[model samples]
Target: MTGEPVLLTCDSGGVRTLVLNRPHRRNALDAELWEALRSALVDAGADRSVRALVLTGAGDAFCSGADLPKRPSTAHPLHRMRTLTEVTLLLHELPMPTVAKVTGVAVGAGWNLALGCDLVIAVPEARFSQIFARRGLSPDCGGTWILPRLVGLQQAKRLALLAETIDAGEALSRGLVTWVVAAADVDAFTDDVTARLAAGPPVALAQTKALLNENTDRTLREALAGEARAQAVNFATADAPEAYAAFAEKREARFTGRWAVPTRTEDDA
Candidate 1:
């Protein structure tokens, strides 16, 4: 908590929340902050107890993209870009669900980071922009890839080219964000959504997320095969049995994050 940590982390009810802590620069990503975020995400992916993750900013703005270094740096610029790539991929491919809680401005790499999450919950006053063009830069952090997939190639091109700012309602209509609520309700709504995700079966949710994410790259036959495999894997987990038992007992299932399936003996096989 000391020494002005660039990222803040908190865990509650199986949800791990990561807040970008650079409010003075609108939570901009500096080299140190980028590395810190990458490490935090990698750790979260490996932690079974962290059933879901919520990402947000400390102040009014979610993020304003990368901070401009005041002077020429000794380090190669591409190194930072490479790090951003790794961070975005980690967010996209995390096993558990990830949510972005966006309030104020989310522009450039910041907006792309939100897009990388499985879901985004934004307040009505939230503002978003693919501001790379305005900055004389092309999109990075998987913006080019994710934007086209979410909003179609033409719309993506227009947004990327124009660099026009859009409000939360427009973002929701364009499929840029999952949900938009009043600023006053954002905290309550995000908490409810994250809690629901945290309470779900971890293995099943992970499988579902993987299946959907890979769908665009897969043929129909391949997709079906993948679904079959995913379902088989889900069935092997304790959660499947727990769900059936819960159904019979007319009660909620208690998922324990136990995914290991017992090895079958010859007789059982």
Candidate 2:
């Protein structure tokens, strides 16, 4: 579409949504769209008000991967790939939880994009593929790293090397998908889930997410120490005390993520 944003963004209930906007080409990642995505992700990561993030595609198909025919030839592949690497790392490192809502095909880099999220939800008819080998390329967008961690080494190899497309059920079986729901209910289900996440204790949830992501590479002792550090930080936040009070009162906790210890404010000065 002429003069349209390559990425569409919206905010609701502390949830930020970033949608790939190139539906006519199955939301392919041209250079423009990649930059758009990176910018949006950076903004989402920096915004403390955003407690959860959702990524999806417009019209149909989550994404078909790079727009090969339109890919820029001016720069070397390595240089061009830095953008993808940054985007992937940003998604992985964002403080809040992230979700991928896959409506249709998510292949190649597109598939890796979804895999980078904390959770993935897809419709029954959705499809996924590593799709790199068939295109005479290796996986990018953190695909190589995330695949084996998600599936086993063998399953990851099969998907990446064979480049075969899989239905949502098989993806679910292989643990690539968190849930597969009816297309009709996916929107409402996603909304409900993200709303719940947005309402969680922001500081604690962010620390928990970071711990889990880093634990795979950590020793038992290191992970325990990390957990201790996270808990110490959480204890300094108002939410932890609020939760304790709510439990004693037999009511729900309203977490504000404010600092529990006294701190100087501009008004105090």
Candidate 3:
């Protein structure tokens, strides 16, 4: 996982695929890989050419965990924790929709990374685990915060406390993953979703994401007001006109907005 090349490439329909390239290490996140991934995510979010992102791994495993060899580093432990927190926050704050395509084992921080995405589509063969407990450590990479929100508090406790591996079927059933396709179909399914999102209204999607992330923490009055404000802004976009016109013309709407919007600052649960 050390000094591994980050696999980043954008295709037609504005789908940017960030593949974890360290197959030998099961795509573990070493310090270098973390920085590379942070930079790549930042660049993709800023690039208008990239409307959607599909985060996946290179070979058999989606990701194992943080690179164990890099632990207890030259820097202070608290510094490492702070750095990891910022990196995880960056992933969660990306403007465009991110979909994690999990095909194999996604353990510890790897699982958390996938959970950070707006949606996760995994293959039947994929497995997920929060193995930090097994290794005599606490969870990192937004796992502690995101897991409880995804699955209930009890489920989150089970995952973190037991540190046991669960398969894709269980993950989907527990509301952790959005969908579970066959192993051969995971890539194609993710591609289809990404393409669909890319062709849709980018501003609307971003607004929806923003609302979702803030909804649980906001009061009902505040949430409604926020939605109305967001809707007001979205209605003024070019895509909104095209959408109404397409409806009247009995055709599909072709949306094209690509700029990133400012993420709303809100307190987390």
Evaluated with TM-score, which candidate comes out highest?
2
lDDT of 1: 0.93
TM-score on alpha carbons, each prediction: 0.95, 0.96, 0.91
Clashes of each: 0, 0, 0
Model 3 CA deviation exceeding 4 Å by range:
1-4, 258-269
**TM match of model 3 to true structure:** 0.91
Q: RMSD to native for every prediction?
A: 1.9, 2.3, 6.3
- In candidate 2, what are the lDDT values of residues 1-269, reduced to their tens digit? 98999899999999999999999999999989999999998999989999999999998899999889654498887889899999999999999999999999999999999999999999998999989898899999899888999888999899989999999999999899999999999999999999999999999999999999999989999999999999999999999989999999999899888988888899999
lDDT of 1 at 160: 97
Model 2: residue 257 alpha-carbon error in angstroms: 1.3
Model 2 Cα RMSD, 1 decimal: 2.3
Worst-scoring 10-residue span by lDDT in model 3: 260-269
Question: Per-model C-alpha lDDT, please?
Answer: 0.93, 0.94, 0.86
lDDT of 3: 0.86
Ranking by TM-score: 2, 1, 3
